[model samples]
Target: MNKGQISNTLRQYRLLYPLDKLRYLVERNKNKKLNEKFKKDNPEISLPPDYLMYESFQIDYSKYYFGGKTTAEWIFKLLGKHINLSGGKILDWGCGPGRLIRHMPDISNDQSSFYGTDYNKESIQWCKNNIQKVTFNHNNLEAILPYEDNTFDAIYGISIFTHLSKEMHFNWFNELKRVLKTGGVILITTQGENFRPKLTGEERKKFDQGELIVKGNVKEGHRTYSAFHPDPFLKLVFEDVDILDKIVISPKNKGYLPQDRWILKKKALV
Candidate 1:
């Protein structure tokens, strides 16, 4: 068959057996327990609570899929190689349920003060109930962080910016910069080049017409995944922040697209 015929055939097959079902299965196992916990904690809490339910769903799915020492340990190791952790303070923006704080090493705990915040009140409550030695708050990205300027030595968010709109990203970027101390570090993760979207001609045309057309795996209880390529997005939002490194996290031979893990440092003013 010719290339065009082959391409058309594959597209038809993909449409016949869309990948959305696979994504659904993955999400089902991932968020089942977290949803149960959330329900148990606040029986009245309902779906689409300002913050997306799929955010929690993604977190839970990540926990089930990616079993590792903790995001905190990975981050600490990454930061320790460059910066000293002694007497540093950390603010975990978009810290849903304090997963990172809960997994931090005991030794590191004494050296750093951990503060966490999210837009979801239920998540903040869950963090308060589940974890100790960390301060948790429910604050939206629009408001100022409830800390003094230059208060934190480090700030991090995992899969946080990927879900935000461009305007919200700009707002939070400024807020993060405001609260972060000079020479501090900010680590965040997002979908990079590895994310694939099968857009039709119409979709592509819309994107060309300045519409943000994001097509990917369907995440349950969420509107849709609106991830962006890291380089340009980071360059635009993090113009003031100095990007230290961009690491791709994927197991060898997995053949799956890797997630972009960015480590950025707040430049010290001379």
Candidate 2:
């Protein structure tokens, strides 16, 4: 069997978790030299622990640190017009280790409040201790947020939906919709058509036919667990909200495939 087939089979029999562990072990030390180099390179910003950095983002410290600033700029570029000029409330749903949230304060022209929520308590704790000006909260894997309904003027989750289960695609979307103010926007990136080359034969076939291709048996919110959203499938998932725009983001370094960025707006009351 191919690698994808073996992975799917292992997932089917619930034996993929150990493989994920092994993958982590193998990658754990891949970037140690660079990690140390980066610490001396940029001593101004406090960084999370290596494992916490890898847990929330990747093993690369440079990407987790500088890339956050670049991505924060890119997010505002995408949602600049939608940003609240009079100081809006923005949320980073599944914000990992404060990568993107940490840069929002200085990057934006407005005085919007920034809040980050993640299920990883370690990441949240790191943010609470190191990051300033933003609020950090820990949430469970369940589809819920700490804020009340219609609380956020804007929200975004980077690669968050790409790691969830099919059920979560719906459940979390509902919860996000609940907390979003009317006319406010939400930004989420997903593994879209541009990522089809990475899919296995079976997954490619199902994805081409407009199915939600899921690779599970690992922890639901873990990076190893992946889900790919076809355009039609994602359309159905966020049908309750108005899809204002869709941008397919190319890979920064060309190693990974492109991801689709969806700009969704909550509709006004009936």
Q: lDDT of each model, Cα atoms only? A: 0.64, 0.86
TM-score of 2: 0.92
* Per-residue lDDT of 13 in model 2: 89
Q: In candidate 2, what are the lDDT values of residues 1-270, reduced to their tens digit?
A: 766777788889887777766766667678878878988888887988777777777878889878888989888777767656348888999988888999998887547788999999989988999999999999999998999999988999989998998889999999999999999999999988777766799789999999999888788898779898999999998887889899876677757776888999999978
How far residue 247's Cα lies from its native spot in candidate 2, in Å, is 0.9
Cα RMSD (angstroms) for every candidate in the order listed = 7.7, 2.0
Q: Which residue ranges in model 1 land beyond 4 Å of their true spot? A: 1-68, 105-109, 141-143, 198-225, 250-256
Please name the candidate that would achieve the greatest TM-score relative to the true structure.
2
Lowest summed lDDT over 10 consecutive residues: which window, candidate 1?
A: 214-223
Query: Candidate 2: misplaced stretches above 4 Å?
Result: 1-3, 10-15, 250-254
Q: What's model 1's overall lDDT?
A: 0.64
List clash counts for every candidate, in order: 0, 0
> What TM-score, computed on C-alpha atoms, does each candidate reach?
0.69, 0.92
